[model samples]
Target: MRQTKIVVTSVEDDNFCKCRFCDKKIAEIKNDIMVPSAEECYKNGNVPVPNFGWFCSQACAVNYETKFDINFAKTKEGKIDYYL
Candidate 1:
């Protein structure tokens, strides 16, 4: 199966990126300068959707998914399957 790739880019200034759902500011840096996993990123209150943008929280992600009729399923191997 093909895994989903999420890329996180750093910003020069404080205005990093905005949440796609709530329009909240998401910081590019925190303390350490290491790439975080999707779960880690979501735990920090910012989930990066592949085609879409950043989502503030899981609630927002769910809201967006439901609103757009997008369905996400996790395989037995823990891979996410996205469908309409």
Candidate 2:
């Protein structure tokens, strides 16, 4: 009989020291929340995980969601299109 050894891999840390949304300094790791950039939020059309509070912390994300149409448009051929 042969015995095999297994290795464990660790997840990469973002090390977010500040809250991207509120621009608040994170005193602790638990309190830290980092959001994506304005372009990312706009491209995704939604907020990503770890992004607490508002969207990308930029006015652009807010404007995109607020002023733009959030409705999903579909063509007669069954093609779907999302606008924001």
Candidate 3:
């Protein structure tokens, strides 16, 4: 009989607690309110861009920027174009 090794994967229950890959503390909340993930609060570049926060890092930021900005710009100009 041949014995096979089984690999077990562990997933942390707290998504907002820290980075699963990096194990970095995302945020510190004193109140009872829930804290947002680092990817949600900071851009992939680690910059805090409110209303559009995302995972901040070289790869993540570039991916998000190209996906959202470039794709949106490809669309026809809308009525609000003059304001922009």
Candidate 4:
């Protein structure tokens, strides 16, 4: 089983860490959380896993891992249209 890494940072200037996958801003109040260790994932002969940063929602996290479009749409001209 693969574990997810979630880094909790202090909210400064009303801004939390942005979602690594979707690039969405995650704003929240500072609180206690239990962060899991990734040492097991890096054990002997284990394949490297990409560290996905903070996420605004679970949907965004899933979309990011699956490479699906959620916050943006692609145009016929191959330009990315952001919905922000």
**Which candidate gets the maximum lDDT versus the true structure?**
1
Off by over 4 Å in 2: 1-16, 28-84
- The Cα local distance difference test for each model comes to 0.55, 0.33, 0.34, 0.38
State TM-scores per candidate: 0.49, 0.17, 0.30, 0.32
How far is each candidate from the true structure, as Cα RMSD in Å? 6.8, 14.3, 16.8, 12.1
What are the clashing pairs of model 3?
Answer: 43-55, 43-56, 44-55, 44-56, 44-57, 45-56, 45-57
Whole-model lDDT for model 1 versus the true structure? 0.55
Candidate 4 regions exceeding 4 Å error are: 1-16, 28-51, 68-84
Between 3 and 4, whose lDDT is larger? 4
Judged by TM-score, which candidate is best? 1
| Cα distance off (Å), candidate 2, residue 16 | 6.5
Please give, for residues 12-83, the per-residue lDDT of candidate 4 as tens digits.
Answer: 344344555655444323343221222321232112213333444544545665686543344465333221
Candidate 2 Cα RMSD (Å): 14.3
Better of 1 and 4 by lDDT: 1
TM-score of 1: 0.49
lDDT by residue for model 1 (1-84), tens? 545455544332444455666767654444533234544555575666556556676677677777889864544654333321
